[model samples]
Target: MRVSIDSATCQGHGRCYDLAPDLFGEDEEGYAVLTELTADRDVPEGREGDARLAAANCPELAVLVHEQVRA
Candidate 1:
């Protein structure tokens, strides 16, 4: 899976980072940061659903989750 964060819509809520620190981070202003742009493997063992939940929970809906299909 791939994650994208829209800086414009972000309000520095830090919910994403809080939910999945390894997958998401926060800038100085607390905006969500996409920790991994490309992944060779699946979402971390226990973080799959958590990450999705975090994105959905964003107040501004700034987080986006995409499933990458390999050939």
Candidate 2:
């Protein structure tokens, strides 16, 4: 899974980072930031649930989680 944050849509509510600090982070202004230590920001091996929770809890709907489509 891949997760991303839309800065424009983000209201800096901090839910993403608060809920999933392992997968998300906050900028200097407390905006949602993708801090995954990977190129594609993969949702780690087992933190997929955290990512989903963060996205679902985002009041601005800024956090986005994209799962691979099954063939």
Off by over 4 Å in 1: 36-46, 69-71
TM-score of each: 0.73, 0.88
* Pairs that clash in candidate 2: none
TM-score of 1: 0.73
Off by over 4 Å in 2: none
Best by lDDT: 2
lDDT of 1 by residue, 1-71 (tens): 66678888999988888877877788787777766521433466557687688888888998887766668
For all the candidates, what are their Cα RMSDs to the real structure? 3.2, 1.7
lDDT by candidate, in order shown: 0.74, 0.82
Q: Candidate 2 at residue 57, lDDT?
A: 97
- Give the per-residue lDDT of model 2 (tens digit) for 1-71: 88888888998999988877767888898887888542377877778788889989999999888986647
The clash numbers for all candidates, in the given order, read 0, 0
